[model samples]
Target: MSAQKRLVWPDVAKGISILGVVLLHIGIGVPEGESTWLYQLNTWLDPLRMPLFFVVSGYFSTKVLQFTLRDVLVKRVWFFLVPYIIWVSIELWTKNLEWQWVFGNEPLTWRELGLNLVLGHNMGWFLHALIMFNLALVAVRKLHPALAMLLSFTPILLLPLNEHIFFIGKALMYLPLFFAGVYFRQAITAFVDAVCRLNVPALMFAVITYAVGFFSRDLWNQFTGEVVLPWYLPGMDYMGSQEVLLLVRFVEQTFQLPMALVMAVAIARIPYVSSFFAFIGRNTLPVYLGHPIALTVGYHYVQIVGQWEISMDGERLVNTTWFWTFVCIILSGAGGLMLWSISKVPGIGWTVYPPSLRQLQEMVMRPPVLRSEPCRD
Candidate 1:
């Protein structure tokens, strides 16, 4: 068994990954039918995003729950469900989206809301997928990790990988990543330890994996078209869904297990980079939420500074694929820096995952000392 050791690159990688996601979201208006340089960057970075998140999430599997299923659900509620509802509602309201129009709802039932929540049918889909993914860890322990992955993976048959609602679809999609986090944690530790040794063969293997994966993706696109590219994920056309999922599992473990280990070892071996990223990793939530907000804030800032394009109501200029990419990085960094400030405050430090206003009102009303000012001499 591997003793618990901190893997620090995840912070910097997550910070980078999360920011990349924001940039990709900002890149929404770019045409999607063909291979472009922007698209390639998106794909290269895309694999890291969720897989890394599941890996980080996996590390805490035992840390979070053990005895009761209720405990698991409760923590998920506080961290995921509650935040998702709050944020999605905020997104919909701010973007002037009518919930009625978006979901085509005439009568809104809790059942429908719950379905929407699980399916990630709303704006906060990442968080939605997160809820189901974490729940999978707690639910399926009787089976071997590989068997659990296979069983959980069955939902891919019924649901398309684009994104789906059934619990199994999510379970299978992310379960492998999470399992790797927990089960192979020692493997990861060993890999990192080996990386600490820094043998030439290990580094060469890492490079080879990157090359095969990258070129395989390009080759898939060139030969089969974008539709059939990535013939080994939840949604590749060449193989059946299960077969592809199995292949993706092999590739991820083959590549990511070592990649995360080697890269993490490389980063942690460095003193300054480790310290900086670890601090950011500890404060991951704020940057995740604040990044997109900051990008828009930056876009408005640029506008005020005269570099802004005058976008007519139907025509928007701030969302070009290239420009918005930089915008997201700068804004996300700004948000991280700002969060570093708020985190310093006494008695108000929980804003990173801000509680509901109802919760806040109660906290304020029950305060021990009012905001009473002292008289100075």
Candidate 2:
């Protein structure tokens, strides 16, 4: 679809999702053993945030399914792979420097790099995982689209993969929701539309779903941490008990997805709010890439300036106040905007934000020059 003709709601949804991600990251950055209202809020919204992002990604993937495999791969390379590699390298380098400064350790080794590549570590792992997911989907769709979707669901119900593998596990965990967006596009669209119309029943359903999901999350967190699982089940000795894990998954599948969708739709229906978020949504790429750096630097700066003896282990923020959370948010937004500005530069920008596949192809396939004049000889 043309840019101007594109749907607004998805962008609004994305805008909201990215903000959620930022807030979640900020919450996580708070020192261990510290708790705040902001952190609790982030925990409540966790199930909805990333799943919503993946679903939207899958929904958009439909647009490219008709392209040749070569074209699709090329698009993925430019849009996701290139940026992922660049950003991951940058992130790792900075992290290595930080570690070295703090502990006088050696830089990351080749083995570490290889393992990270395999596991898709770092903040840019989402982009790496998205590339893999797109390629896998493309391959599966070749057999049959329905079959591809059917296969995606298997991972959701299966036992969780080792969390140490990080990105791989996350990709597996989220695959079904992503494919649901692809296969159930029409239904999702209709549902969003119905909710946007402020259908009273739909609103009520959304509110109730969100409440249940929130409550379930609280219970899950409690059980996983302090409260023991009440009943013994097979694999209770595992890192995450199977029965409790299943219940958590059930909550995600049943309540979180619908709540996220309804919230997105409701936001989209509001004229001013939708417009503001849509702007952020449209520019999420730069924000996503830049925000981590911003957060990292901002946190350190705050520590140094405030002379707060906060532990380097992320044990606690200097002051665990709502005002500090607001400051972090502002810093993140400013950092994102700075990155966006950098991405507009002519030559250097391409390093941070590669050209679109179409642009790259156009540059490669420009018209051959016509020999208009005879040879000088």
Candidate 3:
């Protein structure tokens, strides 16, 4: 396949993943009864959503591996770290302001704030973990490829450390996926192509597996009054024994990974859908950065309109329906576009989205000087 053609499916996959991420976040905020269709839909997608994103990210990280360590660092600084720090600072500031004004709570301590930033607290953790994963991948690949493969399992052993220290826990959880992308990029592409060729049967199988896994979790959660599966959501914390944790992780990986890949392949095969997703995928950074800001703005608007309320059960409630879910998605996309538009401005663009190193070089480099003798000649 040509280079451009090869990129189409991956971009489509990425677009689908980012949209899923936004949808998942929307699901997170809006609590629903277990019987609701929206609830089940969210439940079904929960496992596949973030894992697919990490896998896609990992697949792309292969390109980064070719760069020198200095170049890699520079890339991360402008593309990842700078944006991470700036947006994180803004998020923290806004969150604190919300706490004080809305909830009348004391502000976070300097130490607490510093730790959160360092740890990449909340939604920004993905970028933090990604930076670490890339750095680790670079270090490991310096050894033999086989040895590097072996090192990928180091995170699995540290599964207990998941969600513990700064980005370490999350990094460990997703590192294998990232490394899988790096090492098995060709294999994965072949697998996706093969699956895509199977067409209807492949898509059906993917859907069936996802539904089965979703309902299986729902059944377990219904019986236990808690989600027994290993889901990394806010309220669904895993406090089980080591043995249980291991089992949950096993079940989750086994079910989630295949479903995510299958769904990605299925989505990539659809012409119009793939193009839409590819567009979103190509511009994901801005979407990822700006969606939270958009959501916050929408939240305040709802609040002002008396549409936001706290449920008696202490669950935060907004007057939301399926219609509003679509609205939120549109708003989120709009937010990303707005940020992207702002990024085109001359002086202040870097604050929203950092400039590429090539762009920076072009901006800073002086024009070549022509010698006087050459001019005379």
Candidate 4:
């Protein structure tokens, strides 16, 4: 398959996973196991979203195989960095008013602020470490294929051995996985194609994942106080933070990646569902940026109306956590899509710009109809 064609599942998966990622952060509680089994689904899903995102991202970057050091840095740095910095800067400007009390840390001075604006911090670390991975790859871009593969994982492996630069660690840490996606781009594509061919199996996998995720949440809650899953979000704990050991991460990542891929592929197979979800997938950046704005504004309004009680876990405000959870998903997706579309115009692009090529291309380039499912991954 062509390099461009090799990415369909991952692209779709990327959109799906981001939603999962945002939901985890937005939801106060893990939907592990409540009285009903439904919540465990996200638990199962929760693990996979971020890893596949990184892998698919890695898979595609490696697939393009067209990047130069300069080309890689400019786009990777600017594309991710620019928005991350700008958004976090906005968060800082806004005092991250919602989360300020939730996660208070050292304040940024003018100099410190400017430095981090460049260096990136907190949730913005994805861009910072990603830039590192891209720049590191520049050295091997022209090297023999085998050598490049070996080199990619170097940064990822060295991560566990370090105690500092936790933010920078993910760069090299996931590089191998990224390159692995690229390397096995063919294999992954083939596997996905095969999975797509077996509709029953794919759907079964999706349903089972949903159940698995739901159950796991129950399992985790039953044991979280003692289980020490240890992979808590960065800075959320006092152990100063450390990357998950490689082997454990491998076990955990496999479940989530496959869960995400199967879900994306299964969704792609359906018509009405595919179109609606794919629209969300393609316009991912907007949903990512704008939803928080909505969440922030809405959270404040809740307080003013004397309804100041919004549970991150929806159990308190609604009939059930599931109801509000779905609401969060829809609002996040719509908020992102609307804001992204608005940002596409010249002046407003900075707020929630579409990825330039596809958004423009999609306007004129019709999304092909999937007849009996396309063969590419």
Candidate 5:
């Protein structure tokens, strides 16, 4: 395979991640009683979604240590930070607007918004995590790569801080996976390549592996009293301690990684499916940044639908729960893509391709590069 073809799977995986995220958020607006399918689907794929994205991101960042500190900071760190600041601001403003409109009260003040931005208390948290992880990697670059990976897990020791500093806890949770991508890039690539050429039996084994991981998780959840277990397994009503839950989560994600790779390669083998998702994957920056805004607005409409009472033969009717749920999902994905298109215009492009204050000035003074796109990697 050509280099480009070989590289297509990560983009395809990213396409899946962004879409799964959008689906999860859209499902949140659905009424609990009516959300069974959405809930189950999102829950089953949870391990694959963000984990795959982070691993791919880490794989791309494998060379960060080789770059000058300034280049890493300016080009990569600032690249994500600038957008995180701008969009988190927009997210806060729109949320404040919603609170005022819906409840006739503004719960978030300018002070609170500023604090949230600093702490990253919003959906744009993935970007915030990217900033911290990159900085963390830079700080440890002088250490042996394995030692750095080991140190990344030390963040888990700060589980207590999770209650107050949510983003820190989350970044710590995924940091090891990011490090894995950095140190194990060769092994991961070879594994993915091998999976892509799988025959039917091998493919079935891959599917069975994924199914076993998810099913075993279901059994674990039952053991922890989170869900029902198999009849043969004794029903142990154990409320899992925090440490145990964390361990299980890591274990499940470990099982999920290879399956996600296999699935991505499987998708890439199909021509049109590969092209469509890979396009989204390449443009994931806009989708990931814009989808929350779209979903938030979409949720406002969904809430309005929930309150909708139609008079049918002088009786009240409040149906269409599933209908609206599907609608919101479709529209949210479309809206995010629409924002992606809007971001192509020069001046407004900064909404997606946000530059630091210095880069902003330089970008304006210089003419655009001919075929330049944002670094999808």
Candidate 6:
């Protein structure tokens, strides 16, 4: 397959994953209940969503990962860092603005924003994590590929550390899957293609296994009496019983990877589905960076009315999960378009593509080196 054709599925995967992210954020502060199917759906997708994105990102970073430290810093680290710094600042500013104007909540101080930018403390942490993962992989780049992969498990096994170091914690949590993508690219590609062919059984197995894992997770929580920690968002804190969380994490991770790949391939094989998602995938950067701002604006506007749901024909369905789901879809689509439009404007476009002249000069001046093999420890 041509290089461009090869990327269609990964892009499709990214498109879907990003959309999932938007949907989750759009529902923020909406109360969760058993009947909230959208909430349930988001819960179900939580595990697979980011792991898939990281893996796909890792797949594409193979050559860059092999670059020398300088090239890696310029090409990969700087690439993610520029936008991360810019957008995190914008996102924090928007949040403070909204809180000050509408919610009467204490706004984050500039010091807080500065600290968050350093610590990867916002929704933009994906970009933040990318910088670290690229650098982290550098140390093991020349280890026997298998040994390096085995070491990737180190982070997941030391999962307890996530509590004390939440910023590095999040990056470490996803690093193994990212490493899998880098080290096992060929095997993963073959698997995706094979599932695309045997899509029916593949999908069924994927769904069944995922369902089993999902439900069993709830059961495990019930069994263990797992409680949400104070500092973490629902379903995100790693401060629970270490032994049980490890088992839970392992099962979830194992099931999540296959399910993610299957879902992407399944979507890619459909007639119109593949192309549509691929288009979204191709244009994900704008949506990823802009959707939070868009959603934040929409959210506060809704808060002014003191209602989280919409009115249709003079009827308010405040508790209708489907209504919220529909609204999220509409907002996500509109937000994406709005961001895309804003990106076309001059000068202001730096919010999305904020690279310094020095960085640009470095990129242009640097010559590509043969893939470096770091000295093995």
Best by TM-score: 5
Give TM-scores for every candidate, taking all chains together and pairing residue i with residue i.
Answer: 0.67, 0.80, 0.78, 0.68, 0.82, 0.79
Give candidate 1 misplaced runs (Cα > 4 Å).
Answer: 1-7, 29-43, 97-116, 160-172, 224-257, 296-328, 334-377
Model-by-model lDDT, in order? 0.56, 0.70, 0.68, 0.58, 0.75, 0.73
Q: Rank the candidates by lDDT, best first.
A: 5, 6, 2, 3, 4, 1
Query: Can you tell me which runs of candidate 4 are displaced by over 4 Å?
Result: 1-8, 29-39, 99-108, 112-120, 156-164, 199-247, 255-259, 304-331, 354-377
Tens-place lDDT per residue, model 5, 140-174, is: 88899878989988865565555577875576658
Which residue runs does candidate 6 get wrong by more than 4 Å? 1-5, 31-34, 101-104, 156-161, 199-219, 224-239, 242-247, 305-325, 354-359, 362-377
Each model's total of backbone clashes: 0, 4, 0, 16, 0, 0
Error of 5 at 311 (Å): 16
Which candidate leads the pack in lDDT?
5
- Evaluation by TM-score, superior candidate among 5 and 6: 5
Clashes of 4: 16
Evaluation by lDDT, superior candidate among 3 and 6: 6
Off by over 4 Å in 2: 1-6, 32-34, 143-145, 156-161, 207-239, 242-247, 301-307, 310-324, 357-377
Over all chains combined, what TM-score does candidate 5 have?
0.82
Tell me, what's the RMSD of every candidate? 7.7, 5.1, 6.2, 11.7, 8.7, 9.8
Q: Mind sharing the TM-score for model 1?
A: 0.67
lDDT digits (tens) for residues 281-361 of candidate 2: 888887887788777677644554575543334446544445466677888899789878888989778766788878878
TM-score between model 3 and native:
0.78
Query: For model 5, how big is the CA root-mean-square deviation?
Result: 8.7
